[model samples]
Target: MQIQDLPYSDPGVPDARSGPHLLWWLWRNQLGGQLRSLAWGLLHFVSVSALPFCVGLAIQAVVEESGTDLALTGALMLLCGIGIAVGDTFLHRAAVTNWITAAARVQQLLARKAAHLGSALTRRVAAGEVVAVSTGDVEKIGWFVEALSRFTAAAVTVVVACVGLLVYQPALGVVVAVGLPVVALAALPLLPRATRRADLQREKAGRATELASDTVAGLRVLRGIGGEDLFLDRYRRASQEVRHAAVRSARMWSLISAIQVLLPGLLLIAVVWHGIHLARHGRITVGELVTVYSAVMILSYPLRHFEEIAMAYSFSRPSAKRAARVLSLERPTDAGGSREAGVPRGDLYDPATGLLAAEGLLTAVVCGDPDAAGRLAERLGGHPAEPGVSVLLGGVPLDDLPLDSARTAVLVQDKDPVLLSGTLRELLDVPASGAVSAEDALAAAQCEDVLEALVQGSLEAADPMDARITERGRSLSGGQRQRLALARSLVTDPGVLVLDEPTSAVDSHTEARIADGLRRLRTGRTTVVFTSSPLLLDRADRVALVHEGEVLAVGVHRELVATDPRYRAVVTRETEEDPAPAGADRNLTGQGALLGASDKLAEIEESA
Candidate 1:
């Protein structure tokens, strides 16, 4: 709550009912800081507003030949100067503290939501949208929060000055006071237009950000099909649209800025002209005329705060709405959860699929459909594809267990697992059971070559463990990435590990080695590998063949291969029994090679 006691232990649940409500909640929560800022800001403005009065008194004292009054007026001016400096300095400090704390609070709330939702956050929201909210939108919300107090201080001082003027001098005060309010509220009509334009720009910018994020995430696949240029073109057009919207928004804001300047200048002219008329008509003295002129000039400064406050609100309202919307999202698995964890070691059962992965066994599920396999993998990890249905462990629904509990109980590595950007050591530095060391897991995953590849790719890497992996491991090949992901999963040493197509990208030689190492490393643990690779199938403790959504067969690989045609059909394409002779697969890309060069070279030469 205080400046030094920053980064609240708990940033309290946000009032995400709406954007305006969230802003109000933040204001009320940060009341202490806001009040401090307002007090200092009020002092600063009051001192500034006092300067013209002291100047007018000095003029009047000089006109009346009063030396004592003049001296006292000069002393008061010095005191006001001191007040101005001290108040201004502390006002800025408080505002900045409030700004930073407000931003930090929002960040903490967002991070908590992300952790609570886990991977489901991305399933519900776009990665780019979340990025925008956490980065750009946070600053906007904080700006509006800090600006509120300053604007209030400025408004209060202006009103006090107007009342003082009305009592001291009627004719000139009536003209100046009425005109100032009109000038302050002059930009109201244009605000809705400016807000609309700004919202359009932000919306387009968010879309452009989403496009760029998606393009970068899939840059590998895009390059594979030679479609990177096409995506690049799309992103370029989206960026252009954002640029145009920004220009339009800027144009509207510029018009508002012009009005703020132009209207005040016009007010100054009218006040000066009317005051000279009053002085010439013998209604006011020269000193009074000078005082009125000085007051009008001093008061115009605070009017700008009104325009600034409007601009800040216009920009941040949408940002708060976005933050509120993201925070409002709830995970489908959030309600049926509990603190009491289920048994970690048990026979995992998916009632939907009628397949069971018993404890202390390596089970292979040969599902002909990859989509079905992917769904099964998600279910095994408590992320059921369908609503109201969950995989069970030890007669307890996986969804009913606490998030961390379910995670420790079952680890499901997606078929195409991603390696986040970090050092090689960090990639494997997971919350683990400590049963398997990183080095041992790497060996078990046959990642020696992958480690060497990382070391070779970096010029400054003295150790493979220190080598940095690029974002999503784009710098590594598909097989190397799979091996690294496998090693990371192995290091966790969970009670049950589900791997979907763990070695689909690797060759038979590597696949065989990985399968042996996998079985050796997971000797007594529950491991379910969804694979159709014959090399992996032959080593499993049991194989279940799933055809059309039903478990059709369950037996040893050799028995199933000999007795069940469905199981054999699924794994047959991957069976590499006979070896090809040398040069058998060499490309016959040229004319002579296609005609069997050694046998047809002489005949082709004679024909030519």
Candidate 2:
């Protein structure tokens, strides 16, 4: 379908197997607008063609008859000039409208895809690639869309000009007609090379953008570890590689530009030579010869558009492909309905792992492998697993339920929580409509200080909304961000809350408060917190030790340690100095102070 026929301004269809078909679709859909632009552009170019004839006529009129009625010819020339100016204005306006609208439509489609994919987007695609596609690639695609109409108009103008030349003087016309095609088609030969260079440049640019993004994100950690120089060097290397690729692309474009310039000039010279030969033979007047020369010169304007369209298409095809890739990502689906008899009041189960989290009971999972815990958390939250794992909430398979229903029922608080920039109150506000007061949620998450700080954050301003939070809450400490994220989740009051390390950063006092608050706030709710913290585990009614991808033991925190040596070693950090095993669910547990205390106790006992 043409762009005009698209449901939205930009049709971001992902099935790129039919790129030409889609381009045709866009043409058909926006036919009216395209036609309007074409008509205007044609009128403008035809006006240019008329100018040469008018100049020749005016020159002949001046030489042959001093008192001739030049008024009529002069009036025609003035009118054509006015028409060209007016048509050019409207043509550009229509083209720009099409460009901006089409780009916006694509953006809208991408945004919809992002919303549907949710967290899955990051899992499926690189963050940097998405960033590049949205910003730079989109503009490239828009550039092509805007050029299409004008390009068509330019081609039409060239054809009309060539035909006019043929009718005016056959000998000069043949040269005009033949020479124009050579100039317009000159850029076609270089397209393949140009496109290859553009692709290389885009690829390298994407890599560089990714590296820069990664470096920026990890800048704090790099600085902490005194690896800033190393990361900077890596980024510099990536930047240089991108620069090299860009230079290659520029070189190809420069060659194309040279051809565009040379071919048009050569065509004009050949047409002028033929026109002069015709004039010498008394076949055409000297004024007609001048007109032929003027037409050939005028033809250059539209001929340039031919090269531009080629360049635009070469750049846009890949950009559209990139955009399509993002749009093609499928939203996760559940095969069957999970609507059971009860209101989901039972322990969670994962058939893939043969593990059961008992209902109304706090469960602690100690995994020898941290990745195993993260996978378990993903499963427990009804999130799509990396295959071979299925999570069931209240005997209902999570994947079976609609995504919205599943998410509403189960909340997964990630280890690295994202805090959107907003006021403290705004940040605490969540999906559930007024189920829990902000104050209550804050108290439950033990975030009294957080609120106090926020209130104090904008003490001078009359409104709390005036408080400024930097992007990603960079202004806040990691622990504060974590607590705030927890508070937001608590406010949601989901039936099942799967936390991946809820208190890994806070001091013991705050950790204990948070634990108490969670227990009190999440009363009667199925809450599963993935933590190796003694404080959180002690609060759990039962604990499960995961070993070899299985629940080796399931019991209270104390009982699991008493019975399972591996569980004791894993939780107490007796096996390794590090509290978490290699690749353990990120120490999402904010209760590092409790774990630190546990470590000190173990040291004292070992010394004894």
Candidate 3:
């Protein structure tokens, strides 16, 4: 594919079996570009090598005092020079094209994998490693791929030059031919040591990168806890380790480079020494000696390709391995049934926990363990952690449904939902079935305070929807960000909305208003909220107490509090309490309103 056609329209499936295999796959895919680059490289090197031969011929013509031969040789020299200039320029162009296109293809493949796996990608691979692969690692892989053609052409040039030298002068040719292979093979023993050092350096660098990413991500928390210096010290140590490893790796490579230069220099001296001996013996003439010397010098340039190709492979092998590991990750597939056949939509049930969220009701689940709650929430949304486990919707296995269909059918908003950086309108811009408008969703989410906050900050022109939100809504207050996420979820209006701690960051008053608004907005829809807030629990049509791993009690909030001591302790955070009187459920429903009115009056009295 052309470089411009990049980010391939499909980014076709990758062969992620192994690192070497991935590199081979990439090479095969870009054979056209590689061949073009190889052809241009051959032309460039051949023309460069021919320059020495032309000079030798000119010297012979001049020595013989043949005017016609001198003219023809001069003309040949000019043509070789022109060929060198043109070939070198285009060779560079083709090689660069191959490099960029190969990198682009790998980048596209990575991006596609990221999108496919979503949050699961980070779970399988470190965020920093993913970043490294897509950026620096991509370039390294492309470098190896692009260098392949040039290396091939260089090898070919060396072989052809050796053959030409043998034909031109047998004595000097034998010396060069024998010495060239020795020079090339001499460095092979050092490569394994260098490669091992390179791998060590890469490992250290990846850890350092991961440490930096994690530290940055938790900078706010570290500052809050007064642990910034501790983290800084840790990162400093990691950075030092990375630097030490890099220096060590560099030392090995430097030794290899030294060997590369030293061995070639020794070969060059041997060839020159032999050529002089042959000349002294009258076995070769001055023109032939000059030609043999020039050919050996030209051969040195191609010999360096061996070292470069080795270094490239050493660096790129690990990078390709990391990239392949990420690309090999596959989304969880259901072995139960065909998703294309479609499944019914109704009540959401997790057989693992025996938690049933009846259709068209706002079911609240109270769990003592937050982690269990989160896992249960994910399970209810068809993303069970265990294989062969499934969440059923309308008596049909949710996992059996197509990914898009499952997502559309059940929307799960985790406790810590992410808000992408964009304008408020852009943030709310999501694929919806049009059941609710932006204004309605905002109102349902009780986001008037969020809008007012944006307006008061003058973050946008009169319309709060146009206000820009910083990354993950860092500029917004915790409560405001939570409400904005709730509004965004409400807009989708999925059949079953699973919310985990939707109002954990909000005040009781705001949480109360949100609970009421949510119940009203999702009156006829299935909404499963995983929370322990009394305000939200009071409003739930049916409340289930999840103790250990199974549903222990299923009833209204008042009934569960009165009957189950474990449920009461989880919800109220107290072990001892008076049992509610008869008709307490009826009174509690009224108390929800009375509490709201009392809070408002207190606010007004304080203001007055």
lDDT of each: 0.86, 0.75, 0.85
Candidates arranged by TM-score, highest first: 3, 1, 2
Model 3 worst lDDT run, 10 consecutive residues: 586-595
> 446 in model 1: Cα distance from truth in Å?
0.9
Candidate 3 differs from the real structure by a C-alpha RMSD in angstroms, to one decimal, of: 3.4
Task: Compose the digit string of candidate 3's lDDT tens values, residues 95-141.
Answer: 89888988898999999888656666786799999998999999999
> What's the distance in Å from true for residue 571, model 2?
1.2
Candidate 3: clashing pairs of residues:
none
* TM-score between candidate 3 and the true structure: 0.92
Best by TM-score: 3
Q: Give per-model CA RMSD.
A: 8.3, 6.1, 3.4
lDDT of 2 at 511: 80
Best-first order by lDDT = 1, 3, 2
Residue 410 of model 2 has an lDDT of 76
Task: Check candidate 1 and list the clashing pairs.
Answer: none
